[model samples]
Target: MLKRFPFFLMLLVGLAVASCKDDEDKPPVTPAPDTVSFVATISGSQQVPLNASTATGAFTGTYDRTSKTLTYNVTFSGLTPTSGHIHLGGPGRTGGFKVPFNSLTSPITGSQVLDQQTADSLLAGRTYVNLHTTAFSGGEIRGNIQQGTTAPVPPVEFAALLTGGQQVPANGSRAGGALVAAYYPATRLLTYNVTFSGLTPTSGHIHLGGPGRTGGFKVPFNSLTSPITGSQVLDQQTADSLLAGRTYVNLHTAAFPGGEIRGNIRERRLGITLGASINSAQQVQPNASAATGTFTGTYDRTTSLLTYSVTYTGLTPMAGHIHLGGPGRTGGFKVPFNSLTSPITGSQVLDQQTADSLLTDRTYVNLHTTTFPGGEIRGDIKVK
Candidate 1:
């Protein structure tokens, strides 16, 4: 009996050891990471029916890998949102689009295909969010998504100049063969217009793919027409994707269908403009180059315009201009200025077409006068 009891105890011990070993060999079961969320606020000026007004809205979205769904909830306080959607593509990268939500009042959400291709592209930073409006008819606001973070704020808007020069003139507008680009801070909207000094563009349009890709690639947001002052807007999804530094703006013409002007858009930290006026007291002092006196303002959601007052130290404020390119300090050829006159002050209509340019930070503001031949004073339009 004692021997039998010992055998039984040994058998039980061996069974327990085997069970522990089996548990150790089993695969680990880890809980998925918690979902991340963010809120994107869009505040900018837009062209309305009778007059141009400002629009202010916010969007909340979440990306869940466990569910493979991207959900959005947008709200507008100042103006009404006509429509909006989530698009696919990087800043300049071109690709097909899938519409998730069509209206702004309701929650916009959807899931992506859980595949190796989609996952790889996402990791490579090739996705974004976009919202549209009636005034823009295109996309009024845009934002991109990245791993580890949710609802990152976009920096100040800027423009990309086609002119080789890096500085803007204080007097006459740089109306040479240039394309005007604009950016919106909150929505990251980028808008662009290609002007040929009265001569229409034969086959000019904005390229969505990177600079390495072909110039005559597919239309960015839609078919961009030339010979007209009219502009086109890029999708928010596309614009957001651009924030990852994979997108670029490439202008094409019959002479250079592949591309004429090309530059990567980024956030603006400074503004350079030439301001001069041959007036009574300041005839000789037509050039402005003072650091203390600069044009600064706040965006009025009521009007969708940036209200600002210019304080001159060396020169007088005569004509104001805006460009879409890079920081110009010396002498650069930028596009026409989007005037923010009366009803709105220092406000550029951030429509669909111009929104695309603004996202790339390819826009600038300048004060021009007759005194400064090229440009007396230059300051970059930076965002706080």
Candidate 2:
């Protein structure tokens, strides 16, 4: 009886121990729903034609994973937001998805309820928050709610311009040297000067244009102006266009109207043209050995004008004009003289001032032939 009693007690103890171990191995039930908090920067090229500081704000929003609900509190610093919404969809898709917040005013704040799937999508980076304004009815500020990562700061490329060099002779000067154009790509600010042969000068201006095309007014050249010097104070939009190969430079004179000496300026590269050498304005010469090309469209910046006339001719054009350059040799970007789209013929009216920087000598318009895919005939513009 005593042995049996001891065995029974030991069995009970072992069973109790085994039961507790089993319970410990099992996972606990899902925890009650809790709110997830996150802060994100919301910015976008909200306006169709985006500009600096267009999209603004740090938007704060919260998601209740348990209730599948979300709320957003947003405010802008510079511009007041006229409209706001919580946009759904990833990178490329239609804007319509969900709207939780509506009628967002300054110090924009709002809330919305989301379903389980939508909440999951938002966490997965399939959705985003966006705000709208009068300037950007589409959307100005946007942020993708997801696992955040830090971004590395970009390095700045800066340089200084040197002044005072040996003077060059009249009617003749040395060539082949580095010309520095200090440009801030983000702002479109430019400081440039050319250094070459010794020569004397009265004053100068930087022409914006290319073959047979002269750009708008001059960006005054100052002391820092090198061999040939000038400053083309430009806005961010204008500067972006200029960097897009739409502007150039030419030190002007009463003698050289179109541009005395011209060089097409683009990002990092410059094409120089002597004022005396080139064909007549508006004359397009085609090459025999090359595939045909033509002047198709014309656009003016200062005036905001645009004209499209499809004209095509075999060979390529030698000379053309959107004249904006003065005299001397400095050209920057170029406008589209001939393109795959509309070609040009006789006379064509142009836009008032649409992307006018493109019309400046800063761009390129060369005759392309089968033999010369690069270019066959070329000419820079001078104001006649």
Candidate 3:
């Protein structure tokens, strides 16, 4: 027994030595990433009181939670920025400056140590970055800071500089106006704001034609008042026409019945497309039906707003909802559609939690019918 005990002791020591050697041979543990990346899309349309400058920019940064340090870089074109800074503000609301860049140059780079309050605001997306140019001293290009490595897709922007020279046969009227708008491709919706001066506008319409041609009226302003603001859901053909730069905004007046001032609509950037395919198979309990549908929409990250259109073929839907769940999973409802007809179109403001789930591809559209009380058709939303 004593001799066996000695041999067992030696075996135990040998095992311990081998285990230690194995530990040494294994790769070193990689430290978990402590930095969170953030990004923003800068444009003139994002300014508090929207500007007419065509400048665009991008802001990228990384926040180190451990060190409380923020490192950032800014790149822009089309404007000679005189200064820039980070400001404490929310979308459409202005606030005081929080941090300043060391230099006012394109491809601006710097680092700052943020206090607890500023850090919290930044992570909550309550901060914005902007650049001031001679033309727009208040800030020519601006964007709200949002968390994520990839910049959120910006809404497609369009603008028109109305002038008498662009009018068909040209006009001698000393008047001018401007149009700034955004188009969401998924919902086929266009929201515009127009401002004019030196004319009492009698009527205004978005005409379908090129720069020097006169065509039929497409969309009309809800009001002839200055600062006209409204939205319109366009058909596929009209949307295509606008994207082709074949549309113009024409404001008619008592003096010039045709058009006092006009400008061709020009696209600043293409829009983001989000869509889903609906079928019975995606339901928690798959149904045996020929019903199928599609959901197409766009999410404006800056406003946390979602606009969508749903169309189905085989099922008579009684209701529809946005369910919080991933593919093949059942979850609670997050949003309800305003209408249940064959084609459902609506917009809703999403809370942070719901928006996060949507951006992560963890939400779906479920259409309920009388035959299937739960859901007749389901589709997982995806960004394209």
Candidate 4:
């Protein structure tokens, strides 16, 4: 009986050892996912007003629920893009533009912090990305910013060039000013800076009104000094009004009690970089001049303004102009530069028709010289 008891004890010990071994061999459990992934296969056929373009693209993104930040990358082939934007819409629908990407080059990558409203719409699969090309100024490739996983839960920039002419009763103050501002949607905070010259600012306020009109004050600066820099938390109504372009910065002076210099607080739209490589080869009738040059500029859609600089080598430019034409073609002059010297820099406010032509890859830069007579060098202006 004693020997049988010993055997039983040993058997129980062996079983316990085997159980411990089994537990050690088990796999570890996986933690829950913290980020959501999204993807889109962009195609021309997906455009609201579909077209026959054969270009295709891919968009991949990740959204962090806790941080409310979206990181994305976009790649495409078969077309040169002019601009890209994220719009609020669903499949087969058209809506207003929400976020404009800072760059048009592929593969485009960027990170943006979203506000509660935008984040909700994104998670609900109610947003889409549209890429615009010269061939299709509206949109060439379209993709719905859809997500496979679900979770949770933003910056608008604006600027203004202050001038006396913008004042309600246009002043002759020979003074100028500028205002640059950015609004964070997440916290409803607006940070701004106002700089002025030739005026002693006694007071300043952001008033509610359109161009050439005036209304009640919505926001008052904490300081009346020049180069006023401050931040304020805005309510929903005030933020909406500001974003809708119904606000202006008014600086009051002793000489002008009403206002001295005023500027419309316009939302700075996404700007497109335009460039051209000017050589004798791009002329309608190609020449053999050894001169080469480069044209670079930024086009602001909101202001219809093109600020540009031209640089050249090996030739003396007599005159230069932006002509309306496609690549390898010729057309009439649309915009002439103020100076013909090398490294020419200037800004021009384009009419609607001329702006449209420029956006559609139908414009060229022609630099004429006495030697070449007609045109010493030419290059097609295009989105870079």
For this target, which candidate reaches the highest TM-score against the unseen true structure?
3
lDDT (Cα, 0-100) at 323 in candidate 2: 40
Error of 1 at 28 (Å): 10
Which 10-residue window in model 4 sums to the lowest lDDT? 148-157
Candidate order, TM-score descending: 3, 1, 4, 2
Residue range 51-81, candidate 3, lDDT tens digits: 5566789999999999999999999998898
Task: Write the candidate numbers in order of decreasing lDDT.
Answer: 3, 4, 2, 1
Q: Model 4 over residues 134-226: C-alpha lDDT tens digits? A: 889989888877786321111355667676766867756888777767665666767677888998888898888877689988789888776
Please write out the lDDT profile of model 2 over residues 113-223, one tens digit for every residue. Answer: 787767777787667666666876766556555533332111111111111211111233232223445453443445444653333434445545533465674465565
Residue 138 lDDT in candidate 4: 85
> Which candidate has the highest lDDT of all?
3
Lowest summed lDDT across 10 adjacent residues in model 2 is found at: 159-168
Clashing pairs in 4: 114-154, 115-154
lDDT of 2 at 11: 97
lDDT of each: 0.45, 0.46, 0.84, 0.79
The candidate 3 region of ten consecutive residues with least summed lDDT is 265-274
Model 3 TM:
0.45
What lDDT score goes with residue 363 in model 3? 87
TM-score of every candidate: 0.39, 0.34, 0.45, 0.38
